[model samples]
Target: MPNNSNENSPPKVSRQILRFLVIGGSSVAIDGICYALITTWSGISPDVAKGISYVCGMLFGFWGNKVWTFESTKRSVSEPIFYVLIYACTLGLNVGINRAVLLLAGDEFRLLGFFLATGTTTVANFVGMKFLAFREQLPADSTTSAPSSEPPEVAIPVSDRRAA
Candidate 1:
């Protein structure tokens, strides 16, 4: 059996990355669908619709990443909060990159800007989710409670003991 401690093995990391990409694609689809529906069918402002759709996508991403992609068993109340903060930061990064690219390259390269923003934010979100939001936390007593490196003492009864 594979050792559990060696979680950073190439195969394991590859699997995690693949799962992350799948979840990311699903999240993006959810975001796009929601955005389109809200913008086309409702009176909501486009900006507000975007925000709502982003949140929906963020929620799905968090759930999928936590449960399937990362497979983290450690739980903490701060996980969701950290996830939201990370997504918010990535959202700003995405918008900034897209706008900056458009400004530099002109509106003719709008698709390039979109692709750049999407790619950059995707990478950022993966890093943030892996390292911050769902990282496994060592137990509080792990250090102090570690087993001794010395061999365990073996008992010898008088009948079993022989003179050296």
Candidate 2:
């Protein structure tokens, strides 16, 4: 049978990816604006301004991804921990890949290295955020009932069973 409803709608994963990108873009814009404002209007140093803006962006990204991109309802203490870990790993990956490409390809290919690193880290971030950081955890007891002392029941063919 044809699934008409499914045919009309994009897959759930696609929607999630789109939402994730939107959230990421927004976060970047927020980071840039905050950085500019801090650096321009305040006496804070550029490095400190960058750090503050980065934190602001990260906080917004976390909330947006958790509430909108993943549509997660139940909150776990480990979710933020996982998010931070994933981001940290990706950040390292991005820098390492960029540096490697620059070393191998020369400074002339700086833009190329930058793009490669960005692309790799973007994909890694998405996958990690989707599968690991935002994954729902089931309770240990939810998968099983309390153990019973009785033997398990076995089915018998109706024709072979004795009449009550």
Candidate 3:
């Protein structure tokens, strides 16, 4: 049988986690910059700016997570569509968490609300992406078959051996 030892090896979990964190950091930076710029220069309302920035940031996050974090080079047509669906679902969760935090903390502590909201969203996104979105990268099976040790053997009758 052909050697297949490497097939059973587990994925590089640490590396994947690190890449995810790095991509998430970059996405956060993009979101913050876009939010700040539009709010400051474009005369956009804070809510509108936040909405635009969130979309932009999500795009960045999707691309970064797909290409860099997961190392997925699949250019299949379904990939982007799947990503968009996930992003839209997560966006709703993000907004809901943000609003909930804001309401609980009251308007006086808006900064705290924002931080709490972002933190919760980040955790949720990471868990979802790592476990569900990129599960295909990891091996699906655990058991492997190795070659048997017993060798083929034959026995001849004593009478036949003597005659020969």
Candidate 4:
């Protein structure tokens, strides 16, 4: 029974990572679609359209990560502020890397540059969120207990001690 209980423990960190990846992927798709539509239909510059789309995507990513991925229901004023700060920092990094890639790869292969930039940013964001944004929730619960440091002593047979 005890062993069975241990087997049922939830895999916390892996589950959290998987959830974050899934949500982040969805948010990126949303951002890309929004940026494409705005640039194509509204005659907006790609940069402006990307900025607007990023903000929308950031909002989706924040709520998705905060509530679903981290299971963090703490909604104090500071929460949003901290999240926004992180988003802004990541966004700046993303844009810088994207521009650098474009410059290096040349205008002819700008699309490839953008893809590489996005991939890099995705990995960076995942690491940042795991370590910085959600490091508070450590030592997740498990059913199994660790063995005690003290050595166990031999015990007399119960029947021998009682009757003999």
For every candidate, C-alpha RMSD to the true structure in Å: 4.8, 5.5, 8.4, 7.5
* Candidate 1 similarity to native, TM-score: 0.73
Instruction: Order the candidates by lDDT, highest first.
Output: 1, 2, 4, 3
Candidate 2 lDDT tens digits, 1-164: 43335321458779888999999999999999999999999999999999999999999999999999988776788889989999999999999999999999999999999999999988898888888888755544443566679887788889878863
Please report how far candidate 1 places residue 57 from its true position, in Å.
Answer: 2.0
Clashes of 4: 0
Winner by lDDT: 1
Is 3 or 4 the stronger prediction by lDDT?
A: 4
Q: What does the lDDT come to for candidate 3?
A: 0.73
Query: Model 1: residues >4 Å from true position, as ranges?
Result: 1-5, 35-50, 139-164
| Model 4 C-alpha lDDT per residue in residues 1-164, reported as the tens digit of each score | 23343221368667877898899888889899999889889978889999999888888998888888877755567656767677677678878877887788778877886777677777777666655665443233442346558785578898888775
Per-residue alpha-carbon lDDT of candidate 3 for residues 1-164, written as tens digits (9 for 90 to 100): 54455532456666777787898788889999999999989988999999899888878988999888776766676666766666667778777777877788777877776777677766776666765565444343423444448663568789889865
lDDT of each: 0.89, 0.87, 0.73, 0.74
User: How many clashes show up per model?
Assistant: 0, 0, 0, 0
Give the poorly placed runs of model 3, Cα more than 4 Å off: 1-11, 87-124, 137-164
**Angstrom error at residue 15, model 4:** 2.6
lDDT score for candidate 4 against the true structure = 0.74
- Tell how far residue 60 is off in model 4, in angstroms: 2.4
**Model 4 error, position 30 (Å):** 4.7
What does the lDDT read for residue 1 in candidate 3? Answer: 53
